[model samples]
Target: MKQIINTKFAKNIFLSALALFSTVTIMAQEEDTSSKFSLSGSIDAYYRTTFKDGGDATTATPTSFANQTGFALGMANLIGTYEMGKTGVVVDLVFGPRGTEATFNNDILNGVINQAYAYWNVSDKTTLTVGRFNTWVGYEVIAPAANFNYSVSYLFSNGPFSHLGAKADFALSDDVSLMLAITNPWDTNDISASGTYAVGGQLGVYGQFLNAYYDGGGQGGLGFEIDYTGGFDISEDFFFGINAAYNSNSETDSGFYGAAIYPQFTTSESFAIGLRGEYFAATQDGFDDVPVTALTLTGSFTKENLILKPEIRLDSFGSDNEPFLNSNGEATNSLSSFALAAIYSF
Candidate 1:
């Protein structure tokens, strides 16, 4: 496992350097002075307090964000993009608990490089990308800067995070495109513990008011997952979105499936309110199927490059579900929490 991981790392670095050299050389011959390098990212932090009487309720929340009491650092992310004509590279690095949990699995290399990828435009309509990149599965992104709500949803929490491999993106038309990729096993952020790969991709359609996307893949002996996401601009000030996903692990003989909906309304240039409702379930032998449902209401206020998000969330478990602990340390079926977060982007 260690040898394979080392070799993969070396290969990734080698390919990135080689591609950069070749592309830059080609661009130099063409005398394309349009090449540019840019830097951007965000810094975020939050405070959370559970309404429960008993325990911290951090574990009861069952999702990302506000894991600790009082104040917590969400993350400090830095992304650099370099483009020289048809070739480009993106390097994203992150730190803090939010970054650690979102980008890394286990404790290895936590809060390091979230994604590092190189891309080449093979033609006007096709492009190739290699290295580690974020997954195209869910509607909400890993970055807080790209999300409407400050907290994460159950769907995003349970789905694949990122993949490391090679991918090809094809622009079929003005409003349609296709992506195909073969990547290391799910959530293998830096290395593949299984020493295997999986195939997956996304098919997307973009319209004036509606957009739809689907992505899925299966690992050799691990499992399979498929996710669908859609969004509609109901009006200039209102928007709606939905996400559904299913994943099955053959090794554990268990499966997980869920769906979520998002609705938002902008009342003014500085304030917007959004709501997320989600249902999630886990299936395994000896336990009856009971789904978990959650609803989150978020209000976002923006001032220049700074944004504040105040959110309230309630989660309920089915009658047979006992995943949460009550204030007195008793098994419970429901949990509620509140959080306030701030983000600065440039």
Candidate 2:
């Protein structure tokens, strides 16, 4: 019996050694065929102040982020990507005041993580991704380096930010694509306390996308939203972009609708100008609608990896509401502000 036990133990050890050898060999082969890992990110800062009769920074800006008075820190973004064979992973981290606000719904354990996801290319036409990712419904993203404007629009500010879910993307043809996702309720990053999930779909064709998201009713739930985002290039240096969205909550019978247009012209390789004109409104059950119009003009100047943007914005509200305080500390119907932002990307 002792000899038999000794022989069995030897066999087990040999099998383990063989398994380790096989794993190492496979890993080496994969490394040889994989693409190089990449690291990239950006840092940003800005100074903002209201003009004329507009109040301080906190009251003058009704939207989100970059609202602090005077000089302020934006955020530090760092993204690392690794691809091996048909699988890839992206780990994006953000730090600073802007990052804190953007990840307000994130899990306490992973506070600074903006996005962490893994994707698999199942075939030439299909890919599957899982984990936390930025929302696909809006025209603007959370990263400052990616947006042409320094401040966010009302439509992008009010919409969902990021989602934790699993998604499948399919390339229908050269010009058409489709994506479907199942996720926790809007902005519910870690887990759903209400034990509910949301569904999202996107249809893309010729640089245009139609997006839809629906969540049954739960904490931080966005009942349903239908959005259209697209852009067109009229000339070598001229471009036009548009975004329209409608959101509703069947449980409360309240919602909002808005539309915005973006027209940009490039004057030189290092300088460009753009404008954002938006009309937004909000409604509630048994209440009159509140309407507002905002116009923003921004100029972009670039030198190497650094970008500087000088922007001016005006927000006007319908006579029904006075949400701003003027220079004399009196309620007013409009507000105006100016902002200068600097961003460095690599």
Candidate 3:
């Protein structure tokens, strides 16, 4: 069950984290080597047009790149980090529509922060982190530069985006690692979320040509989700990745599940092309089952710190589901869109 957040308790936690950060900074100041600080981020903008302009692109995929017929701002992201011996802090800030929806339901200070977390090195191979951070699940991320496609997948749209918690990461060996975390109920980017905490973890294995990971977690007041992501380098210029996920909410009797595969080919240092095919389904207590299948093809051309992505996507609804609006404003089972996006990173 969800509980009301205690203002005093939340304030105390924030103050404590601030105090710890200050203490570590002071201690590191006395050391011969001064603490290191870095600032980096990216800016993104895109233009998208749907084949059927009457039906908004936002109706097709509920995440970013939802512009219907013209140009739009994707987001501006800024990340700063401070690190010293055994301790560090990260402050990630984002502004724009994409940033706002990344943590839509929970807003602190009217939606300015993406993540503010502190970390400690417990040992050579162990580390602990506290405060809010991004979720370990999902193949795609909020950052446009990190994704191959301009549009997001349904799995990414519906899955948890970030978490508020404390987590520890351990490197067991050269090829294996693990992470364990206890966080405020799922999707709560705000630190003040109350009620029972959720437990989650990730286990990973890395090999010369292949990498695989499994992550899962749940909140008592909400539900649970499990995800698997794997990738293989088929050749020097070719690669493939697959992802699968399942989530269920006990309180609402609703479930969401999906799978996707991504394939890419890089012919040169300046150009690459990729495709993403996904199928997703949703089931609820009293509503008609909704299922979506989509295919996206994207090409990237890069020079220096700038990259350009041109993409096209097609989507279709399940036979039993209600259709989306077509160009003429008539209900239709399929929709298509074209997008061009540019990103500059530093």
Candidate 4:
């Protein structure tokens, strides 16, 4: 019967994601038992083998990797954190199934708290937070030591992940920094969230640009961001600079985004390497007969906790378009896909 109501709606969204991790830390009353809580996440399981150059196998897009072969790929998170003193609470959830968790696979469970916010230090350049945050406008990172561009880019994970509501952080010194948010934009986590395409309110700014001396490392920081999304039927605005990006919409009357400045020279450390080259295109999404073009090249290998990634990609939108899978499953429509990744982190 519709798979028993989709397994009771995935067990009631996993018990409302465990009641949003204990309803505001037990309705806030305070207890500090030596202040300590630590749990972290990262693991994008890999093992893919597919080479479907077939003419037509059910005409692709069953989440297409074409003619779909075996040795699948899934699992993109591992998290948890809790700290005492200055108050702390975090519940990072990600369960992407491929091997276990009652098979029918894709072990879904991401964010009841991908990031749970709570911070306060009311002085020396203020700080405050409410719940669910993270959006510096993207160099590249959903959170993985602020990525240098490693499989998750197409305007930084399709632009927007975690921007719940209520935020404040300003440290206009020691290299200037200021953040402001009054969000609702993303998935909003049920509570009767309505008026959909997404735009309940969002605002942000992060500055760092001054002192220039080349060779990829020497006072290198320049960024600009702008976003005013309110799309339930279309009303979106976007901008980002330090590379380039621009957007406008009711389904794209414009689209220009950029990334192709390979860098990975972080100092005071052991070893690091980040190289990237990317391009994404769309102009006239109001539909002049649909068009989309994509290309990517990525690499990252860090020493510390260990991280390794390698990728290459390409895509085309029409002519019955089929090809685009690079998180190591390797597939490209115009032609290309090869990936190798390994991550061991704490």
Candidate 5:
């Protein structure tokens, strides 16, 4: 009986060793594959206080114009990526303080698809991406959650936001890259139906002068890009681009907006400074005959996880639409105000 029990115990030990070996082999195989495929992303959250003369539905309070404050609380965003060989898949999801505003809302939807794309290399110099994606336009961008420049450009979000279609990237050299995209112009994140469908494309070139890595850790770099996007029924108004950008509708019966932005500066490894100055116009000739041209200046400072931005924006809604909030949280007409905010990202 003792000999029989020893045999059984040996058999169990052998089986356990075999199982462990198989598990280790499988894990090693997975690791080998992952060495070829990489995945990464980030998340941003913040708390804020607001002071105002009670303006806009974006904030609903009138505590004190000089010291009105409330919670600017919300989780900014999250993103994920999967890469294999020359192909990659990336998805970005954003959640904002507003919860989720509308299906029409583009980047900040609670669980919506901000970017779900499959990208592949067509050649050493060219690559292609398909599925819902962002246009290769705009100075400020919606770069996942890992980017420090979190606040968006008015033209970034409010301009022509997103695209659902195809885009190609070509490397001109070590210093330059060009992109072209053709997209469904029903605008973005749109669920409603409109009779006419708009189709559009963008051409962009991105570049930088020089760079350095800090074993000591600091931050400063120089870069710029030009993008043009406009394909419809319009003249004297092609989305011409300089650090430049432009937009014009396809018809005269409807009004459109256009701008040329040449924003650039310098940054230290630990912090930096930059500016965005742009000119804009909106005209819808019949019931409203107004056009506006304005400029905005913004400055920011950053140290590790803390970021503070003091900005002054000037806009002329061409006598048609501006910023205003009534007692019942409603808008009356065109009015404008000034505001400042500080943000921290971790």
Candidate 6:
């Protein structure tokens, strides 16, 4: 009886051990296949005032964001990301003035959906992405936290903001990469009324990119645009960036061309100063070319996840075109402004 009882006890122990090992192995496999989800975003606001003869706050800079007088809200950006093995998804949402302007072409969710895309890693050197994504043509993005200056430039304001379609990214070599995309016409977020589409390509060598875009020329199509965006680190504390683009519409015989340079100097880990000089021009079939020269100086201070930017900007347009008014409400060809912005990121 003692031998039989001891044998039963041993068998029970062996079964329990097996069960425990199986449970651990299952848990390890689950951990390896589990997906990762993350949330990140930013919020920003600014106070702006003009420095012209009339000190008119109404006639601020003609750019996209931070144009409202006195205190104004920039936007709240929320980005959610999910990653599992070789596949991942990103959903970026935004709210407020800046978001509204950036997504002006979105018909359904007007200012809410900034970017929603899914990507799959096809191989070690290639990836495929589908859905809507931010345009890869510009040096500066729509997010205020991503830009050194509180205000935007003409090139960014007029360029395509986002695209909806499919793209392939290829890593040609350690330093060379290529991207090709086909999408609905520029800024057509929901659907294309004209049933037209666009194609874009980008070649990257080192950190510079040569980007090109073309669409079927029609009433509302963006005919073609070629852009070059790049930056160089001059020293440990100084950096220089450049952006140049030419856009033309064959149907309308109208388009714009512009170039801008950014020079920044970091004083410390928390503070930096930057300058942007731009020359932009517009051409129409019958109208004379209208050109504008703009200069902006900005200082950035950072603490933790919060950033403070104080900026001064000046714009001078051609004498033939007076788009701004002075303190006396008279036509003028120049405008100057000052702004202080606060941005918090997480």
lDDT of 4 at 188: 44
Clashing pairs in 1: 54-327
Clashing pairs in 6: 54-327
Candidate 1, residue 165: how far the Cα is off, in Å: 0.5
Q: Per-residue lDDT tens digits of candidate 5, residues 1-346?
A: 0011133343354346445544554554555554244344333343233223453334422111111233343345445776654556787655553223312444334446667776765469977676676545554445323222333433444344455555667777775766655333434443212212223334333432111100110010101123443222223322222333333332333333345443434345544443444444434443334444444454556667655554444444444554445445565333233334454544
lDDT of 3 by residue, 177-266 (tens): 888876666666554234345667888888322211222223433566788887899999999988888877666777788899999999
RMSD of each: 5.0, 10.6, 4.6, 21.3, 18.2, 15.8
lDDT string for model 1 (138-200, tens) is 878888989988888877887777778778888999988888876766776565555455667
Which is superior by TM-score, 3 or 4?
A: 3
> Which candidate number would show the highest lDDT if scored against the true structure?
6
Predicted candidate 2 versus true structure: per-residue lDDT over 294-342, tens digit per residue: 9999999999999999999999999978887767777778888989999
Return model 5's CA RMSD, one decimal: 18.2
Which ranges in model 2 have alpha carbons more than 4 Å from their true place? Answer: 1-35, 54-58, 105-110, 286-288
TM-score of each: 0.85, 0.88, 0.85, 0.30, 0.58, 0.89
Write one digit per residue (lDDT tens) for candidate 4, span 20-103: 434544444254345676777766544323233532122222221112233334345556666654446566554444212211
In candidate 2, position 202 carries an lDDT of 100
Sliding window of 10 residues with minimal summed lDDT for model 5: 213-222
Which candidate, 1 or 4, has the higher TM-score?
1
Candidate with more favorable, higher lDDT: 2 or 6:
6
lDDT of 5: 0.41
Model 3 lDDT, full chain set: 0.75
Poorest 10 consecutive residues by lDDT, candidate 6? 1-10
